[model samples]
Target: MPFTPITAEQRFVLDHVVRVRELAATERFAAASDDVIDAVLEGVGAFAAGEWAPLLRAGDTVGARWTPEGVRMPDGYAEAYHDYVDGGWGTIGVPEAHGGQGLPFAIQTAVLDTLGTANMAFALCPTLTVGAIEALAHHGSAEQQRLYLPHLATGAWTGTMNLTEPQAGSDVGALRTTATPLGDGTWRIKGTKIFISFGDHDMAENIVHLVLARTPDAPVGTKGISLFLVPKFRLDEDGRPGAANDVRVVSIEHKMGLHASPTCVLSFGDHDDCVGELIGPEHGGMRAMFTMMNNARLNVGLQGVQAAEAATQAAVAYALERVQSARAGGTSRDAVRIVEHPDVRRMLMRMKAQTQAARALVYYAAGQVDRAGSGDARARGRLELVTPLAKAHGTDLGNEVASLGIQVHGGMGYIEETGAAQFFRDVRITSIYEGTNGIQAADLVGRKLALGREASGGGVFAELIADMRDEAQDARLIALIDACEATGQALADASTDDRLAASYPFLTMVSVATCGWLMERQGRAATDDAPFMRMKRACVRFYLEQIVPEALGLVAAAQAPADVLYAVEAELFAE
Candidate 1:
């Protein structure tokens, strides 16, 4: 059912702007010579429209079934897995030397967008696999690399990060998993890991778990944690599967959404000798693990993109199909479609603008990821600054877009059969899971801001603002750039005193303000590009005018001490 009224702005972003191939012509953006992104997208579209899309409802309705053996995923997931792996979709971003296609994350992001949109449950497995591969590729030993990389790269085996415990949650320092050194170079791991994705599955022959545990007599707190590569099945010298290791899937989480994803609770060394190889050096697991976590966060950000785009698509379809009563300007005899209503237009427009802007941000960041390898260290640091922002903000945008999607449907949205409610439930966890939005804000202020503080000798986030301003292409983009500067300046001024706590609201405002600002930049860059470029420019205008205005209040709130948020008695409102 389509909306009764559709605004011109909403039409542009929702109906006109194409998928991930928008900036595929950008040379540095393409990881593969062929249209790998389009190819994957095409496959995803076919699968989604046919086999996979049908599962979306089943996933939400039926969810996953838990049994003594493990969580039984929806039917046909293994068959889907065979196609996904055999098609090379799983290894798009892995290095070519390790038997992967070594595609750029941008291309992979597009593919992922399709996969998640098709059936989010199915996407979680490979997303976690890519994260584990990232950790191993960066920190694994040569022997470890030779043993695991090929299989990981080829999608012949899957991987998991054994992080959370029953009591640990997001705090890694509280984990009590122990890794005892054996006489040989191997180690025996013993402990339980909760919420592990694809923890135990017959999808693949082996599962490589990058586990964090402590050595005996090690220093207390996070400093003592070490990362180990513990496999569900040990690999032989030739990298093939050897003996089954001592790991068992005790149970799986019965989550509200992503039902196809098996959230497993794994018990390691329930026997006595679970052999595991160490990744990187001892007591340095935190650093190595962060590599995976950060990469995973970025992937999580793209999952937001997936949700936003999918929701946008669904909203547009609903708006066009649903024929409601006449608009205020029209009589019942001359009844207009609900898309003709102004308020409906406003909601859809904001949704379209924000979603497209997020896509542009992540796409550019994807380019930056490629440039980081070939560019200077400063170039690399700049990429690092955008990483958290993209991950944090992109996912936030997902929820916002999905919410708007629900709003567009109104009464019908509340109905479970409409599927609008499902989108809302699925995207809700993005912000909380990958280190809460609060955590992302603190990292930006502490780590990235600390770097800016040292370099400028005083001003924080100023260089970025200045660089953005200078890149402005037209009068409007420049004006919006100035507004972001004012926002950034307010944040800088608020942080003048060394004892001051930086307001997260300020960080959030500037983050959105910058996103609005960059959308304009992207629009301007597309001057010579395509209809997609025109769509981008139009959305940029919408973001600058509609989205950034919301920042005014947040900037005002940033003037206050951060302790105010902390001081609030959260428990008082619990009831």
Candidate 2:
């Protein structure tokens, strides 16, 4: 099946659930007028479905090839990438001062969501480049920004984030990559970094690597770490690709999915000459890397939305066409399409509801990003509190929806020939890469829940719950809100062990409540009885009637103490 962009649905969510017009009211995003927004939605939707969708199967089957010289992308991958760059799709979110359109970040999120739906592996290239653009725009020296931002913004050169070494995955403080300052104002970066996405490929002229490393005399742990700009090709005096920078792709991983994107193991300064430039102040790598990681976490969440959208489309199409058993309560005894079956309808409705809900949640987070860009300090606080929810819940929905898609397909979904399984395999990494969903849940309880605490003992999380209660008063949502407040207070007062034990369920409760509120907004705004509106109302009703009520069940788990988990003796578990 050719992938189709859910352009109309995206526009509806933007107009109703998140309200992108509010962003247009501000000076920073005034250029994002309705006309521009519509053109972008229609134009990028066409570009993605036409240019990128054709490569989906080939990207998975042929994958990227590795040689000692470098990594070679699958056939047509380079042409497709250049087509994306030439069409200016990559410039939507970058600042106009850096040769971009300077639209709201939410718009960029929409663009990536559409593109990733078409071809997810291919979309990873630009996703990382966008993160690079953000980090450089904020922390790079004027010279660094002037030299790199334009190319990165235009996709002339790509970028990568190299933080995961073999020994340091989540425990980033354990990294041993070293950066030694050279007298000529450059640093020599030496170490092997693993799991570098888009580390090297034939698509771009150069790859700019943002590396995290420690100085020789720096302190231990993350406090000693610093960020560096280590390009695959050093820039010439005129600031174009010049000498080779001694960063070699040791090998690319043979992964279960995302084959088109080269997950490279990179060896820097193997020949004793990897030149790098400092990004921010010395020993401030975590802060700088967090800028990139935060952007990536949201985009990763969008990937979940992407997978859900694609899987939902495929499942719905198949269900409508494939004939199965006779309708359960119909007059005709003859076989009917599986979609007519009540059980299959239930699965399909669940998939659609989850997809829309996740999209709204992610887009709302993006809107917060735009508000933060407009210098709303409270918006920043709200964004931080919602980030983990959006990241963890969105991806969790993706996995769940894709699994349900397979179930809807019966025997066909398990086979790769139908392409249904690919959605699950490709999306499986999103929840893992940008901080595991488990880690995101922990962050929600550990850090974000207490953000911006006022003297009144309420903070950003409390404020958000209040807003939700004010906006949505449905009984299902109110129950969730009450549970969320009660559990949040309990976690706040609980011990460290208890908090960690309750984190995952608490994250789920808050996420469902948030989505329930957005779904209600969407349901209310969908007033007409047209086909789209009818289906919209039906999905909303299903979500509220079926899905939202489940959050109440999780309340018990959310408040369960740590003793239940620790009661199992660790040594006895092996028995």
What tens-digit string does per-residue lDDT give for candidate 2 at 127-212? Answer: 99999998999899999999999999989899999999999999999999999989888999999999999999999999999999
Candidate 2, residue 444: how far the Cα is off, in Å: 0.8
lDDT, model 2: 0.92
Off by over 4 Å in 2: none
Scored against the true structure, residue 125 in model 1 reaches a CA lDDT of 77
Candidate 1 local accuracy as lDDT? 0.72
lDDT of 1 by residue, 1-575 (tens): 11111122222222122222433444544555444544655665665556556667776777667777556666766677777777777777777777777666656666666677666666777888888888888888887777788888767788888889999988989999999999789999999999887787667878889999999988988999999999888877766788978888888887766666777889999997788988999999999998888777877787787778777778878887778777877655566666788888887778878777776666556655655654545556666777778778888889999899999989888898898877778878888776877678767755665565666663445666677677655454455456556655555545443213553665566567567666665565556556656666677778777777676556455566666656668896676
Mark the 10 consecutive residues where model 2 has the least summed lDDT: 448-457
Clashing pairs in 2: none
> How do all models score by TM-score?
0.88, 0.99
Model 1: runs farther than 4 Å from truth? 1-31, 34-51, 452-460, 473-502, 525-534, 563-575
Q: For candidate 1, which ten residues in a row score worst on lDDT?
A: 1-10
